[model samples]
Target chain A: MNITLKQAEKIIAVAKEKSIEIDTKMNIAVVDAGANLVAFARMDGAWLGSLDISIKKAKTARYFDMNTGIIGELSQPGGPLFNIEHSNNGLITFPGGVPIKNAAGEIIGAIGVSGSSVENDHTVAEAGALAI
Target chain B: MNITLKQAEKIIAVAKEKSIEIDTKMNIAVVDAGANLVAFARMDGAWLGSLDISIKKAKTARYFDMNTGIIGELSQPGGPLFNIEHSNNGLITFPGGVPIKNAAGEIIGAIGVSGSSVENDHTVAEAGALAI
Candidate 1:
């Protein structure tokens, strides 16, 4: 199933709310199952450098069908997925990306958040993905 | 000026309306001046393979400050821009991508359309780019 624009907006809103609650700005990106951008928001005062990182994070989650934090751990040196961060042009194998799943437990899309500490980014991204 | 999510949604709406009027499914993509994806939509039944092409087209337009069709012509063998398409990780040097400009005529971003015939793609992309 495809991720509708309304759903994407809902995810962004949830993530933005969380970011504000934590007193941090964020660049949020939502991508469809095919890893194409569906919606994005760069909050006021968000770092410009994190703009693409948000998208890449979402893409990495979708591509691997798991959260980026898990991937990061797996891609550590001597790990089974070592050097995977260098794949797919470049992926953000960090904590800010989370897979979006439907009631059927099928992955539909992913949400990525950046512009804060990795832990905070992950928190915001988790809020968004869970909202879906 | 950066293309806000609201502005990108407006552009996509215009393009989708035009696509409906022409009875064609489309993959529409928008990118900021930095040639990074900001928003994208793949209408139901749009060719899946055109997904990446749509993003690439928008990047090509932003990179060259012109339409992809114009770039196609200039990049022809023996043309001054010969082999230019290969420069930017492979540009789509054809119709369907247009630069997005502000009131002062400064390009702010770009829009790209695919899934329909090249002519129809260009028409829809132009409609979106003109909306701003």
Candidate 2:
């Protein structure tokens, strides 16, 4: 299964809406099932560095098929997947990434949110992933 | 040690067919084991930004002898391969790049596709790689 350009745009729209509702500017990114970037948006005044992080977060979630927060936990020093962030160019193991699924309960893509606290980032990403 | 233009074209032809089958425009590139370009094709209305990405993806696949997606999973921040992309200009660790093999299962080259969803890109590239 995969995501379409229209679907990617919808994900971004919902994510942007969530960021506005929270009063936090954000960098949002969506990647299709293969973990390649499909769409991205950087809100005005958003942290520039976060633009890359947002995209990486989206890719990471799709690569592992799990939340980045859980990856963060598993990647802790001495943990099972420790040093995992060292793979895949660079992965964001913290919160803010969520998988997007289709009506068939199949993962179609993922959304990543940044430019705010990890909690806020996760919240925004969740909002976007639910759009479909 | 390398791929011929004829073979590269054949690969691209198959890839293009798959791309058309999936209804996605794509920029496709084929590279020999030396990480050198052998052939390329840009589907009508493919993403211009992905032109460079498609080439780099082919080179990255050849250099690593594995799907870029797998390399991505191993190169996160704390993973053993963190910063691997820094070598050889920059590697595209995401999907859509696949290694080509000959009848003896020997690595010959790689194919990369960009445009539409990563799922479609990879599907097209895989079809191309299998042609050889």
Candidate 3:
């Protein structure tokens, strides 16, 4: 099922709170099952560059149904997915992108975060995914 | 919201000061958090071609939350982000771009400068970014 705007907002709120709790600003984006952006938030003082990255991360996670970081590993120089980031307009195959699954374990959407380190980005995104 | 014209003008002011102090002609551009152009200035006698370069550099810095030079290094052949420059329309991965931050240390926008060496470009952009 596709994610609704209300659900997307909820995910963003949860993610934003987590970012604040961690004392970091973030650019967060949520995408529907179709890989389209549903909701986005660029926290005050967040990285401006992250606006594009956060959205791309969400789309990448939903497109592959896997963590963007995993894709990054697979896409290393000699890996099978090499050069994959060149596809899909431009995918961010780094940490901070996670798929959002429903209670039934079916992926319903995805979330992405950027601004802080990859570790923090992934942490914030994971927290948001659990919201859905 | 995003960076305002008045603030962007202030950034340009500092950047222009840097350019003058360094005795370099520069084309400077500032973009708001949305990556939209906010304010720009081309020093008298600056290279005509650098106007576009300055704008693109600012946008590139905001697109990935990293210095354009760093992106340059990462996009080198055999690097993890090889060929990335071809993805985002066109990105100047050399140098001369810096993210502007507000008092909260949030990236409110970015500044890009060209017309001189990459080193000067970066220095001027950094000076501008500190305006806000």
- Using TM-score as the yardstick, the better of models 1 and 3 is 1
Model 2's i-RMS, to one decimal, reads 13.7
Per-residue alpha-carbon lDDT of model 3 for B31-103, expressed as tens digits?
8877789999999999999999999999988876667898888766455445446445667889998878888
What's model 1's TM-score?
0.84
DockQ of all predictions against the true structure, Cα-based: 0.28, 0.03, 0.30
In model 3, the runs with Cα more than 4 Å from the true position are: A4-6, B1-26, B32-35, B38-49, B60-93, B99-110, B124-132
Q: What are the per-residue Cα lDDT tens digits for candidate 2 across B9-106?
A: 68987988998888889888887766665556666557878977998889999898989888988899999898798999888888999999988888
Q: TM-score of model 2 relative to the true fold?
A: 0.55
Off by over 4 Å in 1: A1-6, A20-23, A34-37, A41-45, A77-82
lDDT of 2 by residue, A23-85 (tens): 998888888887876666666557767877898899899998989999999999889999898
Models 1 onward score TM values of 0.84, 0.55, 0.73
Per-model root-mean-square deviation over C-alphas: 2.7, 14.1, 4.3
Better candidate number, 1 or 2, judged by TM-score? 1
- Report, to 2 decimal places, the DockQ of model 3: 0.30
Error of 2 at A105 (Å): 0.5
Worst 10 residues of 2 chain B by lDDT: B36-45
Docking model 3 quality class? acceptable
Q: Which candidate leads the pack in lDDT? A: 1
Q: Model 2: what is its DockQ? A: 0.03
Candidate 1: lDDT of B51? Answer: 79
